[model samples]
Target: MSKMDIYRRSQFFISPPAILKVIEVLILVTAMILFLVDNKCSGDLAFVTIFVLPCVVVALATLISYISAVFVLVGRRNPLTTPTWVKGDVWFNIVSLVVMLVGSILTLTNEGCANNSLTVASIALGFISVILFAISGAVTYLVLVRHQQEVKEAQRAQLNTRRVTMSELA
Candidate 1:
């Protein structure tokens, strides 16, 4: 990343991931409402209900994601955020994103559901969620990758220091 990119990213009130977490929660909630309304009006309630299931599941996932974000954002001593938790977060985002994209595709192609404004809006929100989830996953993955790199650099520096000290002694 460029200096500007890093600068802009770190300048936010909270971290980008935290901001995204809140946005994701809002988007999921909105999508759920839109999906529910669209499904309710689609005639054949039983059949349309199936299409709304993914949104419901995604909403629940958003809740969990939000909690995890909070844990990470909390002041020092927050035990909820370990490397293990970040790995889980990345996996969860990947899975939920796929589920949401599939649901959006299904909703769009379902003949029973009318292609009304609400339906389109719901699908749009789903796409937005997919993008956000993908971004969050990438960011978390990068964090892990960068930490490994930092560790390697530290080890190398320590080794160099030791070599310099030994040569000076000789």
Candidate 2:
């Protein structure tokens, strides 16, 4: 296989969630910068309410989803066959969706606040939450892929050994 093919087959390969996490981090940083730079730019109350508030809500929701996923993954209540990683991922996605819904509602109802700095900080936090959500997703996928690869390797080794023993007997 080519290098790309080998990478594709690897169990420990990077996953979508991992990539998302990186994205989240970047978004959070951007939000922080915006807050720092424009702390006094909140006079346009309508603009802040319509734009910044929604972003803040989104970030918060994403963060919650990320936490939920982590909880599912780390919980030790299930058997080996239960695939905790996958379960965690499912829960994370569900929670994330719910958070997003809540955020949307909040965004719609947002009224501009007097404290521009606080508003900016809230938006920054929202970005941070999204980053966490992405990371959770990536980690879950990586775990699952690794487990599957290990199983396949074990099975292949067993079959090879069997073939050698049969040949020796003959």
Q: Which candidate is the best by TM-score?
A: 1
What Cα-based lDDT does every candidate model obtain? 0.69, 0.51
Best by lDDT: 1
Error of 2 at 42 (Å): 13
Clashes of 2: 5
TM-score for every candidate vs. truth? 0.76, 0.47
Candidate 1 residues 1-170, lDDT tens each? Answer: 54234223233225465567678878877887887764544476654554467667877786787676555546332212246766887888899889888877777777655457887787789889999999988876775566567668989999999999999999
lDDT of 2 by residue, 1-170 (tens): 43223223231224455346446545644654564465454365554444445445555554664455445445632111236645655565456545534443453344443246555454546535644665565566555676568779989999999999999999
Runs in model 2 lying further than 4 Å from the true structure = 1-81, 97-115
lDDT of 2: 0.51
